[model samples]
Target chain A: MAVILITGGARSGKSRRAEMRTRAFPGQPVYVATAEALDTEMEARIAKHRARRGADWIEREVPLDLVGALVATDGGGARLVDCLTLWLSNLMHATRDWEREVTELAAALPRFKSPVVLVTNEVGLGIVPDNALARLYRDAAGTMNQTIADVADEVEFVVAGLPMKLK
Target chain B: MAVILITGGARSGKSRRAEMRTRAFPGQPVYVATAEALDTEMEARIAKHRARRGADWIEREVPLDLVGALVATDGGGARLVDCLTLWLSNLMHATRDWEREVTELAAALPRFKSPVVLVTNEVGLGIVPDNALARLYRDAAGTMNQTIADVADEVEFVVAGLPMKLK
Candidate 1:
């Protein structure tokens, strides 16, 4: 069993890189997408991403409650959590239960049986945003990354379509 | 002489990490800031950042012409280019020959006598932006980072307040 955490800056090809690493595991793949189409633009983006996947893979559109989504996956199945940052953003905008949700999300990663690769956006290197909400999201994402990276069996930082192992 | 490129997601402590790495060099330091305070919020941010630095640094507030800014530094001065993304953004908004400017900027690195640390934000790891300008900026930043990282003697990716050497 492997819990691989993949992180990188926006559009650094993190999702493609994360998916590539999951190929070593022998099972029907599960793509656990954490994005919701709140707007037409986002819906189009989601549709574009979804169209690129292989036909046989199972898809789970999980906006939040990642713990519950993970519980339903097969232990031997290769599960790809397309991203965690968006889910964090979703929670940040919704009810103020993000801390509890993040803790539960971290605790649930260990329950997977085979290989599970997680994709998380690295958004902390730019100027600190002027708004309080953006800062809160940044802090929350950083904390979640550290927590997941700690428990991950492998960690990689993707840049310019390449993967640099961090742990 | 050493050309070091430092990159990370926004607010990932890339700037501070870059300045810290330059401490080993024995020379007067240069902090070449590429940001322009076009608005009140930005002006406040710039003032706050400037307040954090010690008085000894040779501060060069160069907004667009990075190559010219570097050319003015002392040969042995420890140059810390606080950022490249804002410079790129500024160029995008301005009517100027950016390609030529970038070429010159890359060519100026070898002329430095001591360590020169360049900090850049990785903005390509998130969803593809819905707007054209954002997409253009993202692509431009990625290209610029790759361009610098190629010529730099060393490159590092910072995350969650930690530095991980990439090359």
Candidate 2:
């Protein structure tokens, strides 16, 4: 019924807020995780998150091809993409065209029949990165956020584990 | 007349929002900068900000002794402390009692009769810092923000160059 975008820095309650929003919809909830357990710490973190989510959620891990997976859903229930930033990072490492991908995702969002609560991290709010790659990633993340926010029906900023609705 | 908490990451339009808020009050605006230009890059950034602020502001560079500097103000005009994180960093480096200082600052806030706009950064939203010092700094920043936000009349979170009022 709506597209909600929740963005904040790492561990800013964006995911928790997005998870809670899924309850407002009908049928089972879909949890699309963009993060890959590439490292031991990350694997542990992912497990912890999944544990918190419980068995009720239909979990799908999509490191790439996010748009395809999202669109492939039957629009049967509320879908929560645990994060777009990690997905963006995955795409970045794959040397894919991020701009085109972002454009595609934003364009495809409104077509979803059920509400899709998206979680994302805003990483560009820190000091100007010291390296070129970090700077490039920061710029891409900022643009990606703007593109998605422009289309989302509701946008929020999380601070200190609190959600502040922006739109 | 009000205490507005402006919290965001670096370069997130926080300073700009704080600057605009200063216009709503009586008398001149006071700019309390806690950042010390210890490096060439920092010096350049400080100069750029000072130029943007223009010559009208009564600029006070308070690297430490934030509460004292604040209390010493004549309670006239809008006061902006364009970041508490920097001040905290200064205290952290000095091995001072930051918790006590934070408590004192919060206690002293209500005494400022006119509007006081405070700027701060949120550094805890990312992955757990790889280093102990970074982690400590991040935790300190979060606690400090909460301490001040609890006392402030209003709090806003800025993301993607926009502000969302939280209180």
Candidate 3:
């Protein structure tokens, strides 16, 4: 089973690219959303993504415990983890150990039975933030992206709706 | 002449990559810096870049008038504009029209006698900024990147110190 990691900036078409990759694999596509509609903005974004993805996907909202969710959905069609950065945020907000969890996910990715296409953001590519929290989060994001990309069989960095193969 | 655009996140080795490209050209390399040492942090970063690049190259700190600098340095060896995003920031801060300047830079790139290697940050990949100004800057950066990349002879999206060719 192939583990593909698609990364890019905001509105850089990472989700669309991931969906196309997930659909390329055999079986029904599973959309594992890491985002929870915590606010109107998020709810609206979720709705837009749902509209774009259509109703065919077997959707699951697993804000945290991604490894467990992946395990539960292993035997099905390719699982598209719509994003990992939001998952990291969720973990941090929940006081979960993000570094350990990221490492665990990286370890679990190789043994998956079904193809997995994960999307993540490249958050560190901007000016250094003014706050310490932002700095920490961006560093964590960069580390997480590098770790997952190392284990994934394929990696793509998307920009302006175009995907460039990184691995 | 080749006009290369190297875009990546902060500390993503874009300057190092640009230096390599510039050095590959035949004559003495010109380092067109868009940064002014306004703060100690900036001064340190600029010093680090200079240390890494060595002292053999000609350097010019043209924070706003990039097109003018390029035109003035036209017939020399490859000119490495060690970034465009910072230049864009300077333009916006100076109340100059960035879109028009970016378009002008694109138009001027093709006419240069020497090669140009420009570095830029991919600032819009992260979570939406909390402030409107940050959001506006990111949007501006995204548009500028896309516009410049459209005319670039070579475009690379770098991550984790690795280069991924986009064009």
- CAPRI-style quality class for the chain A–B interface of candidate 3: acceptable
lDDT of 1 by residue, A45-163 (tens): 67876776667778899988777888888575788998989888878877759888878767877766767899998876666777777777788888999999988999998785557
How would you class the docking of model 2? incorrect
lDDT of each: 0.80, 0.84, 0.90
Cα lDDT tens digits, model 2, A1-167, are: 69999998665566767888886789899999999899886797799888888899888899988888888775688999978988888999999998999999999999888789999877765566667787888788889999999999999887855777789
Local accuracy of candidate 1 as per-residue lDDT tens digits, B63-122 = 887887777675757899988888887887886766676777888887777678999887
Model 3 bad stretches (over 4 Å): B1-121, B125-128, B136-165
What residue pairs clash in candidate 3, if any at all? A9-B125, A10-B125, A125-B9
In model 3 chain A, the worst 10-residue window by lDDT is A157-166
Model 2 misses residue B85 by how many Å?
6.6
Cα lDDT of model 3 by residue, A1-167, tens digit: 89999998876778988999999999999999999998886898799999999999999999998999999999989999989999988998898999999999999999999999999998875667888888889998999999999999999988855688889
- Number of the candidate with higher TM-score, 1 or 2: 2
Q: Which stretches of candidate 2 lie over 4 Å from their true place?
A: B1-120, B124-164
* lDDT (Cα, tens digit) per residue for candidate 3, span B26-86: 9999999999999999999999999999999999999999999999999989999978889
Model 2 clash pairs? Answer: A1-A115, A10-B125, A125-B10, B1-B114, B1-B115
